[model samples]
Target chain A: MQSRVDATRCLSCRKGYASHAAGTCKECYEESNHKILDLETKVAFLQFSSSLDPSSSPCFSDVVLVASHDATDQTDLAPPVPIHAHKAVLANRSPVFRAMLENQMEEALSGTIKISDVSHDVLRAFVNYLYTAEACLDVKMARDLLEMAEKYQVEHLKAYCEKLIISKLNPGNPLNSFLSCVLASKHKAKNLLDAALSLIVDNMDKFVELEEYEELKKDHPQLVFEIYEAYHAKQVETAALKEKK
Target chain B: MQSRVDATRCLSCRKGYASHAAGTCKECYEESNHKILDLETKVAFLQFSSSLDPSSSPCFSDVVLVASHDATDQTDLAPPVPIHAHKAVLANRSPVFRAMLENQMEEALSGTIKISDVSHDVLRAFVNYLYTAEACLDVKMARDLLEMAEKYQVEHLKAYCEKLIISKLNPGNPLNSFLSCVLASKHKAKNLLDAALSLIVDNMDKFVELEEYEELKKDHPQLVFEIYEAYHAKQVETAALKEKK
Candidate 1:
């Protein structure tokens, strides 16, 4: 018991006095251990949470790191050729592209990353997307990262962007289009099905139509009906508004 | 010109005169003709709009008309059991399904036909959606009514219920799945995507490995990276609530 008391002193102080007292004693040791364990657990929980929740973790630290790293690379030094700038940009100068590059510089300095807020590279990619309606995304990239784009709410840049590539390119390079669709769909990429449909509908001519297709059509009238109805309704609303004027 | 005036006056009377001085006068005749043309234009606009925005139109009235007009002696009394309720009622008792049915009943009795509120059959279909997901939609019906759902902000339901049918179902049949992905993605129906993915993902054995499969197993993550990033981040900050004990 005396030996145990000797071991029970405050870790901060090497003194052995008042071993039974709460603050600097045996009781304190036991209490602090529990407190330390709780602190460690909470720290671990937060660390895990920060990694998962990028926005909450630290203000765009990862974005700054990745962007800075990419910028430092010699390969990214040259002005990226804007793939599909607006017609005005192509005809004159890519103001949007320039503005986007400036924004990237600001973001890099501030150490912030809103995926919706484009970098020069992303803007160039966006232009490329607008013109080509797709981009050659790294097929081998982890899906979780691609999913992150969706999580960050970067509209038109996440999985749907990938869907665009799959649908338009149909690269058929051992990439899974279906999984891409699922991820995009999950992430609220609105045009995913349209993109998929456009791709698959066109492809059905090349491939044999599935039996399930017929059944789905029979059961789901809202599919085509809504399209027809929307087209007509818009026409009617436009006309009504015009007449009211 | 005199006859034209008389014709204009007659039209203004029928169409609700804008001003008393122009009632049935020569100017009124010209105005009435313009009004008729405007009405025609408005109808044309509605037609186009309904086609573009399928969900808003709810073409149920048209479907009902066609089903009734084209009925055969052997036709069933229940309007083919409205495809939506048949599956759920056949499947099991579901509370969401019941709530949807109640909502539909309210819409029908209300008789307002607001773009957001739908009739009983559509509500039943929505309930079916809560159960089976977007997989078994009647393409035309789902597409036509989706706009209504979107307009009214039943966004989650719209994403899950109708768009699933649109993306999964064949668009070639009377029920085209044209609005499938576009609307669903817009409304952020991740489950719908998952449902469609299950139906659509090709040869999963080829792509997903055993370990990867285990990691990707969850329906939703504890710390979702996208929309809730900021919210989750806030969680990290308030984590260490100092307990007195």
Candidate 2:
């Protein structure tokens, strides 16, 4: 009989592992491979070549998204960006856009959908996500996009932005953490909300000392109450768990 | 220490096996599960709600597809079916459709893209596939769609059709098997070619006796040679493998 050394060869991993190592046998490997192939092909079939190119408009795009701030700006940052896109695509992704475009509204008739209170860069990224379902995210970009996503009711983009915001949350930036909690509450994001509440509860002493904490108490007094309520609930739950143990 | 039985639970399959049985040890299973979720979300993101309904033509559809034969038909079998769709959707899927629509040709100007030499049902299904990356396929439907897919240069659909055609290959239908080999060669479908060649080689005597064999030899002498050549090559390879063993 072959020893543990020979038994180490994993069909899936295609590497030698310990005899009790984490890997599938040939059957499971083959099954998963078939599944992966099917899914990859489906993804390929579903994917569209992004129709966001401005100079060469694909012509079929029925509507335009122009950044309100960029339209007024004379500086060479970026000109009044009239981002060409399909109303069908916008409508399909966001119910807000759908209601705006589908009911013979002014937006539909005018063919110029004005997105105010956002920079051209954020607006471009937002429109691109409507077609491609992808975005490059940083903390600031994620927060801006999360607000945009929440406004549009694009649950997918909101979730993607929330994930990025949650991943970036740390003790170094308690203000950002608190803001994330506010966004999580606004978007009703359970995962981000939990992470945010946990961060605030764990570092309660330093959390109140932050600059935004003072402003949040004044601007959003209800949020300050929520933080305490969440902290108390967690303490009670932990005490109950300790008693059972 | 856990016994072999206790250590046998598959995280994916959720069934216990012997310790030496086919499955991953937790880690690979979890990795694949995460991959599956990501892929499923991506697929969901890419999928479109077909904008094909006629009652409330949202007026966004730039072009339409009409069954050419149905338009010409005098009988009341069905009305001249004008399948409404978007030029962007058509172009996104097929280069042929893209070229015809994007070039401002007669079809583009007329806003009516006529699909000739296909039935109303087939044309409807084809347009539906352009919107949703899905189709209901039987053997006849698979063959018809494969031909359309090849014509349109939709590689994913062609591969899907080729897989279906190859899977249905059997000794009982030597002519169909031979035909699949011809399709495989024309389409450069390696998997279908090997499958078709094996079916022909495995039932060589019956293949020669079939009526289509005489027709194939008359119509395509080179294809007959290819079938024999493939059989000979497989025999040599099998002999070499046996010798190595």
Candidate 3:
């Protein structure tokens, strides 16, 4: 009878109810309910958002896959699942990015990305690229991305695209490559002015025309006059050499 | 006689002259001539440039001083003295930059920068700030310069100014305290884009706007959506609390 009583006490202790509770432990129940409530809140938001916005289904699928696949892959600012759930939360949410991504993928598959030919898919891929940035990318794709981003009023995407282009503008790329980059950054995306000009300096000789020179002056007035003087000196020297010859 | 010859040799060595020749050797003559030639070049350029473009006369003077100082100093591509001579050399060849500089400066000092009340001097200062390319600068001057650079077409200057602003966006400077350094970078300069956004994630709520959110969506769709969602969730929670109250 004493042994039976001791066993009963031990069972109650194991159950965490003998010391302070009659049967159910208050702390344990609270913790369990708290977890359930948290899960339910998240699930309800996801379901409500999904039902409200069908256009975000693709993004939602991506989010869901990300959430279920690996809990460790949460480097992005967004939660890894049901991507459209965010759209429901944010006001004036637009599906512009969806188009950007698709366009980028299409352009990648194709050879070049004509600025005029930009579409929704390209925009979506561009958005994805910005979200999940990479260290290395194709130069051609980078250029296309820049042109598209600049056109679409996507400031962040344009900046990213410019950076990639600047990096690829090694000494090996011809001087002509920087002309567009310089113009674009100078006018539309002011942030790339330094990097673009720094690259252009290597090919200063290529800017021959008064028109081209004037354009550079308009963009970077301080640099143009300086370049013109140097060019004139070189011209004079060449003329003298020709006369001697 | 031998001692006399030895003394002559020592004097020749001091003057960078070949000992084989008698008083005032060839090396000394050449060195002296080169120094004179350098001085002459600077003076001629200064005079010609000043007479041709009086507006940039100060720049010319600065260049002459830097060139005449020392070759070693010329090589130092940092703050000490403005390397205006290198710029002068380039300007001598390119007329466009000269015209642009003259026009920009004229516009700035004349107070004709804004469409309504914007001062052109601010714009000119901003362009000059970029042209000078100094790593550090005066705070008040920097803000003024940034505002002007943005006003004019000196986008690169604006970008650099934005970078400087972000770096110094501490709470101490009440006049220019940043609510969100990242948003400031994105809004102020073109190149800052997604890269700047990633750095100031914690402060996104304090500064990001509805228009900016939409803009970010197209370029950095992932960041835009994520930040928007997080921001909205917080708002929702706050609203819920109010309801409870």
Model 3 misplaced regions, further than 4 Å: A1-116, A119-121, A130-136, A182-187, A206-245, B1-245
Docking class of 2: acceptable
Lowest summed lDDT window (length 10), candidate 3 chain B:
B45-54
Tens digit per residue, CA lDDT, model 3, A64-171: 111233233444464333222221111011224334333445532342233335443344454343322222446666666777565555444565667666666654
Q: Write the per-residue lDDT of candidate 2 for residues B1-245, one digit (tens) a residue.
A: 13455444444454544545655544666678777887778677767764555545644677778878775555876677688888877888899988988898999999998877787777777777776777888878877777778788888888888888887888888988888878777767777888888889988888999977778999878889988997798889999999999
Spell out the clash pairs found in candidate 2.
none
Which candidate leads the pack in lDDT?
2
Give the residue spans of candidate 1 off by over 4 A.
Answer: A1-120, A123-151, A156-183, A198-245, B1-245
Error of 1 at A239 (Å): 36
After the best TM-score superposition of candidate 2, give how far the Cα of residue A37 lies from its true spot, in angstroms.
3.8
RMSD of each: 34.9, 3.8, 33.5
After TM-score superposition, the amount by which residue A231's alpha carbon in candidate 3 deviates from its true location, in angstroms, is 8.4
Candidate 3, B40-108: lDDT as tens digits: 332222221211122442321212212123334345564222222222222322243334334545422
**Chain A TM-scores of all predicted models:** 0.27, 0.82, 0.37
The number of the candidate with the highest DockQ is 2
